[model samples]
Target: MSDKPLQRALGTTYRAEMSCGDLGKAIRQAATGPTPGEHTLREARVMQASLTAVGKEIEQQQEPTIAQELRTPVAAALADYAQDTGEILNAVNDAYIDHEDDGAWQDGKTVRMSAPLDELIDVLRALSQSPDAYADLRAAHVRQCAVGLAAVPSRAAGPTYTAPGRNCAAGLGYYDGIAEDIPDSQSKQWRSDVLQRLRNSMGTPPAYSTDPAQHITASWQRDAVRQVKVGGSGFLTDDSTRILDIWATARGDDLDARKLDALQEDMGSDACSRAEETTKQLACTREPSKCP
Candidate 1:
């Protein structure tokens, strides 16, 4: 009826969805808080639905540019949510298959992993109330499926092994080389060189390193923290899920527990050792493998 209602909705949605505003604050809070419950999920759904309704109302307004401006962030946020959740669901399905193949399905190890499916299905049903929403849902699911399929590993090229390629050594070697090339400011040459004078004048450090060990130590520490979060976010929350899969393959034991048991813990230690040795064996040079 009134543009006041539309304007208010637009402003609130803009702050929440577009800027690092209310939604960002909520995300920061949630990151530290206890695991969110169904109430949070319901509130999120209501907010999304209200935003979609507001977008539709904006389409009926006469102001062309203003309406488009209000719609963009709402659409972008919805699209991002759809894409990310779709990727996560696809990954869950892959994990189910992996567990099944490893005989973990028979042992009911996948039960807890699939526990959220029923609630997710209910949410999807509510979201797919219209033909347009159904189309959007299908598109998001298909896009993530494509990404998941593309990421599936093939057997290694080696004659003796049928396992997936373990190219960590090559990748780790490259990272180590890059870290080594970075200059440590404490070096005498770095303090005395002519070009170092210009760099020092510009408040830039020298471009050479005499002590790569310190650089490697700090860089590896940071990378270890970063890569753990990256892998966990990409796959599952359980840090040991993928590792246990590897253990099951190598040790021929289906560790059916929620967390790693004593034997699985021992297997993890062996896995770490074998991984380090394998990296050393596979590296181009006869250097000790560096762990991150």
Candidate 2:
């Protein structure tokens, strides 16, 4: 009934757009005081450790699934929540006389209880309802991959082995546009140079990906083409880097198996079969497991 703006004694303000019960609860707690600190700081610390342990374990998985990526943020939020919760709990004890005033209740006031927990809950909800909730996380990861790819020293500016389906060429083109918005000028040029080099040597037109929308070969041709490419330069350029980067950023990994297949592709197959021993050695240097 008081017209005074409900101020948080901890001096933190939450968003005004909370759902029905949340806004009412905030008002009621502000009018009265924080509930007696039930859970101790030790409990909150334990929760923090657990969440951190879980997050690290999840991160250790090789090339995470979309579901795993989504869960990644949730673990981070919960860990942060536990940390903040511990602070709040510590600050709400009997001796915490800092913010006491006339209207303050016996238990004293402290930071908002739900701020961090609300963040964790929001992440969980977004996982189910919001498609773009983790776009920034994915975009950041894509940018890292692009930068790493770009940083690779340019080849000796001479002829290199070309794959049958131009899979490596197409892979380069696939990431050209994806990296278009990247800030570094050199990073933007690397893929283009590689793609152009391949196109020039491979006799143009069909050397690039025909499916611009898909940015690669047709779905039906993908398996066979990727196989041919894998046995050559395509394994490193296409399957190992570009495809994995884009698919991870887009929250899908449709061709994950192809990555393994590329690694296992016979040295005596496809374009590699025709390549000089020096070229084959170069490829093997990039991935020792593929060496004959």
Model 2 per-residue lDDT tens digits across residues 1-292: 1112232221243354554344334333332223322333332333333333332332343211224343434333332333232222223233323422222222333322232222222222222122232222222222332333232232311121112122222222322222321225444243334233333323111222232213222221242233423122232223333333332333233324554245225212321332233234333433556767
Clashing pairs in 2: none
**Model 1's lDDT to the true fold?**
0.29
lDDT of the structure predicted as candidate 2? 0.29
Per-model RMSD to reference: 20.6, 22.3
Residue 229's lDDT in candidate 1: 34
Clash pairs for candidate 1: none
TM-score, one value per model: 0.23, 0.20
lDDT of each: 0.29, 0.29
* Candidate 1 lDDT, 1-292, residue by residue in tens: 1334323433444332344244333322321224321123333333333333443333343111122232323332333344333322333245533432121122232111121222222233233232233233333332332232223333312221211112212112221222222235422232123122222223221211432222222232222233433111121112223333433343233333433354345433433443343334323122324322
The true-versus-predicted C-alpha distance at residue 17 of model 1, in Å, is 19
